[model samples]
Target chain A: MLIFEPHIHMFSRITDDYERLALAGVRGVLEPAFWLGQNRTSVGTFVDYFETLIGWERHRAQQFGIHHFCTMGLNPREANDDRVNKDVLAILPRYCEKDSCVGVGEIGLDDQTKTEEKFMAEQLELAKRHDLPVLVHTPHRDKKKGFERCIAIVKEQNFPMQKLLLDHGNEETIKITRDLGCWSGFSIYPNTKMDPARMVAIVLEYGVERFVINSAADWGVSDPMMVPRTVVKLEQAGVPRSKIEQLVWKNPIGFFAQSGRISEQMLQQPARANLRETFDGNSVLRGQDPDRV
Target chain B: MSRMHEQLATLLGPAAAGADAEFAKVLADRSHLPVVFPGLPRRLGRNHLGGGRTRVGDATIDLDAFRPCDLAAADLLIRCEASDDELFDLYQHGDIEERTMLLRALHVLPVGPITVRMFGEAQRTNMLVHVEAALCDGDLFARTVGQPGFEPDVANRVLLKLAFLDLPLARCLFAERHANPGLSTMLQDLATEREAAGRAVWRDTWRMIGLAPTAGSAARLVGGLEHGDDGVRAAAAEGLLALGRKDLFAFAEERLPREPRADIRAILQRCLA
Candidate 1:
């Protein structure tokens, strides 16, 4: 039951959530750079956030036995802030080249604002220049429209559609994305996004080719266990175990491996976890005896 | 003559003589060339024509056996030396495949106001591949938006057409640059009309509601908070939160207890937070 959670914001989650994800069979996670609930006011804040995603967050995930990978971008919501966006864009080229950074993403539309689109286009070019895969975040509101807009932009860039992952899709957008020759991503959030039952139905309808299911768990009430939970639902619904494995594990690896960073062997090899491991002066354990555990 | 031969002659014009010589040399040793008709999907049945063999001038070409890379090489040779007018002319009268290839080669073309005009014309047809090539490939649309003569109505039409066709906005060249009040209002009207007709509006329709934040739009967002679909309600809550509408605070507070989903509740909490 090894799993790969394609989209999650572990920076906002508690340390315990990582353990829970690992216990539930999530062997790897790719946390896309996204907006914190409050808008960031400075480029320095974005820089710090990007650093943490590749640095501290990667270390943090390792302690829970999960191999962490991330995609770098100025999130669509924050891209609207002209003040910080320019600086963020300026720094993106450097960060996107990081070893642990898999691709340029969660970059797409939020309000579909001019600034957001401008940054998205630039980031898409950045991804092209780097020859990396893109993890696109479709707007949560007008999702169908957002997905359409996202695909149009990806095509306009002449970026390889096969290398693109259109994230946060619903039933309505799946068929279109699949038809367009891009990978379709479904985030099984507890409430706002697709539910587990709905995900099972989508797999049944769409037949799981280049289809990926993720948690996209962030600061909100999103469940980190959404992937594993959906797996159980799919199994109960009579989906073959092989198909389930493709959606949960293989498909994501295939998509991210386009970045030339991830490999099957890397995902298969277990990352050694030391509960006593500390990032900077921070530890996953606080006052709890590591030896006892 | 083979379609490829004719297309090459049109693309090369005076240069066709030298290119034909190169094509002949390449044809003699076909191992290095790519498959002429790449394994396109069965769904693209129309593209599966001209297979097996064909005649071009004195050459007896094996159309089915050409390398895909050779076609790419031919396109590159033709486009590398072509003028703006020549490229545009070819695009204007080219077949679907040629037009698609020309659009893909837009980055190499000497694009200008005339090229932009051509793009607008192609966009009007709403052909998926042409629309994609015009809007997706180069900065032509972005440049067009920045032109002094650029019309908002035209840009609005492009955006609306994208929604109508269900094309991904991610690739629309001017989508970010042209996210103006006019477009937002148009989207709102479309969403409203669709909802009234009991049709599902594009999800991006809520983005306009969030962006403009008018009293009417706010009211719509508030209405969305109570909508039957959890996704709609959550999206509405997000819009309301982004708007920072203090007036909607009490309304959101009242709805919190009755909110069945924790994700929606989390969004409502953000509105107050």
Candidate 2:
């Protein structure tokens, strides 16, 4: 069964473990530009970060035979900084057109402040101006307010709710996002966020429509393998093979492939035996034994 | 109202008029505003986990909601009410420091009867607090450390350096500690000891011993430790010993009391040791 993890931060992951993920039936990942381990100091940083999200990371993932795409925006964590936010908002237009960039996103509120609401409105406007989708970051704390504010801002901006993918959603937030007709993403984190068992419950409760799962792996204590692990959990929980494929595969393909970054045609390309060489020049597979047919 | 105030009032409303004038006053006079009723008294926070709302005039604001902000252009800014304790929690947790300080200042600003006709005293306090609080912890730390009347600044700098170890700027100041020969010598010795320790992470570093050239590899690595070649048996024993595989300790003690080969025997004996 093909699985798509629609919101993992692969840039925060420092490993060739994407190869392990690829072997486990994960076909694609959509990373969003987030605050690094620390907040950045300038707007020029957002431009460079956007470039890397859609640039270096795409090539890095291709080496493992997995497709990589990204959504770019000023994260809610960084939006708290007025100086950096001002600069990032100014530079966002220039970066929106990059090749593998999917949409303006993972932007919303952390504490649900007026500042966050202001920036969220501006970014939603940018997304509308560029005719792009948005990935909304619902705060881990004060989630109700975050969810409400996200919907309110989208409404205020008159941005279509369908173009928004509200991420880090819990059961409560997911219901609202779904009711608003926006896509809902659950970040399958280790302990503090949605775990595999919880995701199964969400699927059982919500069904799989307009739902996506992301690893949301970052500099914090999180696992990149969580996507495949969740897929396996769904399998063990007696989830249908087709439903699994839809939530983990078809839905993400429908969402991210719209960026015109990675297409079905590109996915149809033969799985290169020499993926490392075909993507990056370095060969990470030099001494490894191949599968014996 | 100032000319700029009158201009903005025509654009937005009477609401936006005196904001610029209040901001200018704050810039001209480097003084802090006073605390008002909306603020949680500094002592009230001793037991509370701090998830409460305070009203700034009619606007209800939460304390924890105060995060970092952009204070470069304070004219158009509207500061939210927040407490110092609440702001400190966010700052310590990596919320931008400048904004937290701004929130702290907002919480402590003195409430006065002289309210600008357009905006109340609380609103004025919020605006100015946001501006002044824009200085981050690093900036504040440097200022406090360098301020005159603080003894020599060296001892305090070292203490501040330790307190801010997690922050990158603190590390730079720590590097400058080398200019002092006394502190420099102690730090150098500490560095040398840390280096000589080899810094080998012990926990999982040995997990791959099964894959390495070891006796354990003969069994577990190649899946033939129980019934492999003689060389494999010997390797498994050596690997088991290296891995500190307690499960195999009894077997090693009885089955292969000691390798007849002096080299192998010494290796196994040392593992037990």
DockQ of each: 0.01, 0.01
Give the alpha carbon lDDT tens digit for every residue of A172-225 in model 2. Answer: 877677777778888998998799999999998889998888888887899888
Among all windows of ten consecutive residues in candidate 1 chain B, which has the lowest summed lDDT?
A: B35-44
Docking class of 1: incorrect
lDDT at position A24, candidate 1: 91
**Where does candidate 2 stray beyond 4 Å?**
A260-262, A270-293, B1-273
The per-residue C-alpha lDDT of model 1 at residue B48 equals 20
lDDT for each residue of candidate 1 in A1-293, tens digit (9 for 90 to 100): 89999999999999889889999989899999998999989998887887788667887898878999999998899889877988888777656755677899889998987777788899999898878899998998888888788878887888888989999888888768877778889999887889999999888987999989998898889899999999999999999999999999999998999987787789786666777545544666778878875
At residue A236, candidate 1 shows an lDDT of 97
User: In model 1, how large is the Cα lDDT of residue A145?
Assistant: 81
Writing each residue's lDDT as its tens digit, candidate 2 over B1-273 gives 143323323332332334444445444542221211111121112122234444333223333433212111111223322234433332222111223333333322322211111112112222222222321222222222333333333433343222122122222222222223333333333333544885312111112243233332323422323422444445545556655656556555554453455554555565566
